[model samples]
Target: MSKEYNVAILGATGAVGTRMIQQLEQSTIPVKSLKLLASSRSAGKQLQFKGQPITVEEATPDSFAGIDLVLSSAGGSVSKKLLPEAVKRGAVCVDNTSAFRMEPDVPLVVPEVNEAALKNHHGIVANPNCSTIQMVVALEPIRKAFGLKQVIVSTYQAASGAGQSALNELKQEAQDYLDGKDIQDDAEILPTKGDKKHYPLAFNLLPQIDVFEDNGYTHEEWKMIHETKKIMLGDMNAKYIKVTATCVRVPVPIAHGETVYFTVDDPSVTVDQLREALKGAPGVVLQDNPAHQVYPQPLNAVGKRDTFVGRLRADEENPGSFNMWVVADNLLKGAAWNTVENAECLVKDNLI
Candidate 1:
């Protein structure tokens, strides 16, 4: 029998953090002990693991004791403070925030795209943004089958990506509107928690996510662009991956969908080639066939673990341009599952 490892889950109360608990229950990694850590406010809350109840504790620098693998989904600041401490105590951390994603030394990974990056980690590995995760998972297969040159993406993301409070706001506001009552604004956390203004997400689409940057693209958009490169290209030099994205938050509660337009270096590549490539790709499901009126949907992608892709067609105006739609559970395959997969890989390869 192999040795069991102790694992830690930071931010054990947040949406992605809670899903980390669920996924770990189903993980193949042998866990000798599980530690649930959060803010002091969340301490003493009961969380279940493998049919047993575990109390949450406030995470501090010393929380990494005896931890073999640590999966952290706490906000960026918490990671900025605790990640190094965890690593100093010899815990391998898989962080789900942007804090370490772009670090020259940190590996930004999606297991399906670049699990190998996990091996070179000096105790910390990063997971890409939820929006970029699905897009790259779908795009990697095509990138491998036919060399890709440039990509343009527009995201239709769900409110749950913001957090549980945003979801509650949407539901309450919808109920108030349906009851013919004045829909009071609880816009404390909608578009972004730290932003100056809160906009009503119910019956509305917010084009701004993660605030605006100097380049006119929101930070979320910049995340997709930079994280895509950091994930796909890693430290390797390429002229450029040539990516641009516009991220928007829609009223949906779960899953994220993307409309992507891409050009391949191989001009001979056709829609048929791309379909065949994805049909055989790991972590990808091809649901195309316009004749049957079949395609991927956010509802279908929700609660599942695969990146769904469909609506494949050649861009009529551009000879080598192609369009495709991709969807995935932003909190699952995009966040929790991917983080769990990284931890599992660490154990499988005996790195943890």
Candidate 2:
């Protein structure tokens, strides 16, 4: 009989956390028990898993007793605080936050792109940022078929990427705009909640996703640039690969779309060759049929675990350069599903 392990879903009350529970149920990981964990206020709430209602419990440091795996999406600070504790109690954790992603010892992974990185995990595996996740998934196959040199991406991220509260605010703002109320009056969350200014996202696009760094790039952009490098190439080779990103938050409620321009080392690479590379790539769906006007869209990508790639075209001036549009359910493939997929990889590799 295959061994079944006890599992816990941290941040069980949040958007991505709840999706983690759903993904876990759909995953192949054999779970002996499922524990839902969240903050004190959210404790005692019942969340269904495989038709069974699991009561969410307060996440204390001691929550990981006898647990074999932990899927965490609880914000960076919460992961920073609880994951080490989970590790201490012998649970292998997959974190969906920026907390330990850049840590030298912690492996920042997108299973499709870098499942091998999981081998080096010191009990915690960091999931790549949501925007970074979808882009890398589409790029990996192309990079493998033709060596990658540079990547430039502009993302149209959804309001859901901010959190449940931001999604709520977006809906209210949209309704207020239709009702002739001031949409800007209650803007408190887009483009980074802690930033000095909040902008209405009802029908507007905010170029900034997170706080701007000294270099003028928002933290979201920084994450994509660095995380793409880290996942595509190891620390030694990461610096050699060039990556840059401009992240924008659109008013859409779910799924993120990105316009990615990439240069491959092989100058002779063609659009058809790129399509062939992505045709059967793991975790990717090729939707490029411009002749029929079919392409990946945010609405169609929702609730799906696959990253959709379309609009493939060669760059006019830059030889071996191509551009494509990629979309994925930010909450599913981006956060929750990726976290669960990491756990599945761990189990398959017997790391957990």
Name the best candidate (by lDDT). 2
Error of 1 at 237 (Å): 8.5
**Tens digits of per-residue lDDT for model 2, 188-234:** 88778888898999899999998989999999988998888888886
RMSD of each: 1.3, 1.0
Best by TM-score: 2
Give candidate 1 regions above 4 Å deviation: 235-238
Q: For candidate 1, which ten residues in a row score worst on lDDT? A: 232-241
Candidate 2: what lDDT?
Answer: 0.93
TM-score of each prediction: 0.97, 0.98
True-vs-predicted CA distance for residue 251, candidate 1, Å: 0.3
RMSD of 1: 1.3
Give the clashing residue pairs of candidate 2, or none. Answer: none
Candidate 1 has which clashing residue pairs, if any? none
Ten contiguous residues with the weakest lDDT in model 2: 232-241
The TM-score measured for candidate 2 stands at: 0.98
Q: Candidate 2, residue 71: CA error in Å? A: 0.6
lDDT of each candidate versus the true structure: 0.90, 0.93
